[model samples]
Target: MSITLVLVVVMAVLYAAGVYQMLERSLTRILIGFLLVGNATNILILLMAGRSGLAPFVTDDGRSYEQIAEEMADPLPQALILTAIVITFGVSAFLLAMIYRRWRLANADQVENDETDASVREDAAGISAQTTADDRALDVLLESSDEGTAAKHGESAMTDDRKEDR
Candidate 1:
């Protein structure tokens, strides 16, 4: 098989596995997913760069500048991929640290859904009455405050000035 086809297949597999792992609740699995995705992205960049050629630097040979430019590989994609690798490494390190701290505090590798999320789901499913009550209370409070403020301030000095200008 051709190298491009092989790389494409590998990239596809990496992306598939990465997305699947990312959907899991475990931090380790998420990290693995990130790594897989990063590798897949690098491969994609390489594939898009087309066939490799000579290095992109000045040479002592007698080749013309235009010839050198034509023969040299495109540097931008390689540079972008290198920068992406460094950024990914830094972010991965930070995530690993955060995961370690979370593990230390919670003593668990799997993340549990937050109570707020559970409450939202319960509200959505019409299984919790408190949600509606809380929302109504907040709406009433906001309406009262708006009316009180409007009555107290009438109109701001800025609005009066703008009206005079018009």
Candidate 2:
């Protein structure tokens, strides 16, 4: 039932490093952070799970149900660890693919600042909503067009369609 000091410290270090790495701009760093955090979480769950004992499925011939239950190791923490491992693997794989693609396409691992984020910052800085509905609609239309959303249904997305439509 007692948790070792060393394990607790390791978990703490993992969490700290994971969080710090997660904040980095590099996709590889983020993946490492995610893995660290997942491992730390697994460690935490294991520590909190208490002493390991006999499997819950086994039943002694003469032992009472209460005694069997007391000796049974909790399955919840083990399941959680398994689930976390799976989620980490899937997400890391996706991140790896994205990193590879970025590297292949641009020869860079650094993520560029998205223009949408910049525009959102500008809106938050000061955009008056006190204007008329017509102005707001026009603004939405213009912004969507600028982003190539083609808010207008008649606008064809492909070159061939464009010739026919226009």
Candidate 3:
């Protein structure tokens, strides 16, 4: 019946669900799992904060600062929660990246499923292969029979002036 008891139960349920979802293959479910776990962690921190009290900020109610300090809520727990939130954000990014990479590794195939994928990959490979250091297409195009005297730094002197042989 107590609020803390109810919160503890809720936290337990959240943690259980989050961990279960984390075991699943779907990225979206994993993301949900991360979020749930993060929230449950926040709740755990809150429970560890002890009994709640008035806000820490001082008010002009004719009370001395010394007398009010005793009832003020502990800022340390709040600060710890903020730190946890930042850590969760950073951890979530890495976790998502790891899950995505794993999914890609497991799902990706060397065998192209369709003609479009095959053609695109083949064309890309061919284009990149030509631009390698051994080919030296630019050097050949820029070379002049006159030797030492090279072309000036202008568009007309560049390889664009002539058709590139593939």
Candidate 4:
């Protein structure tokens, strides 16, 4: 098969794996997904440049320029990829730091199962309810002189609270 075709297939597989890993709840899988995407992007750049040829430095009778320019592999993509890799590395490090914090808080590397999910859901619901109730009371107190205004303010506050929760 052609190199371009092979590279395309590889990039597709990497993208799929990255998506799957990102969907996982564990932070580690998400970081790995990001890494896979970074490498795949680099490979795509390489494929775009086509196959490498002999260095363009040497000339007839073995003459060469001391400050050869075009002889190197397309240095632009390589330079771009190098910068991307560094940025990816920094992002990965930050992700690791966040994961470490989560682990410290939960004392586990793996994400907890249904019980944890349920508790988080319940806590979120309770917080939502409390915030809504508080907003309603505030709306009544602040707009108590006008019935229509109080109702509108209460409705707006609940909508704002929902958006904040999201």
Best by TM-score: 1
As for candidate 4, its clashing pairs are none
In the range 130-157, model 1's lDDT, one tens digit per residue, is 6788899998898678667777888443
lDDT of 3 by residue, 30-49 (tens): 77898899999999999999
Instruction: Please report, in order, the local distance difference test score of every candidate based on alpha carbons.
Output: 0.89, 0.84, 0.81, 0.79
Models ranked on TM-score? 1, 2, 4, 3
Q: Pull out the clashing pairs in model 1.
A: none
**Could you tell me every candidate's TM-score relative to the true structure?**
0.73, 0.66, 0.54, 0.55
Q: Is candidate 2 or candidate 3 better by TM-score?
A: 2
| Steric clashes per prediction | 0, 0, 0, 0
Candidate 2 lDDT score at position 106: 92
**Candidate 3: regions farther than 4 A off:** 59-62, 99-166
> RMSD per prediction, one decimal?
10.6, 16.2, 14.4, 10.4
Q: Against the correct fold, how does model 4 do in TM-score?
A: 0.55
Q: Candidate 2 or 4, higher lDDT?
A: 2
Two-way TM-score contest, 1 vs 3, winner? 1
lDDT value, residue 143 of candidate 3: 64
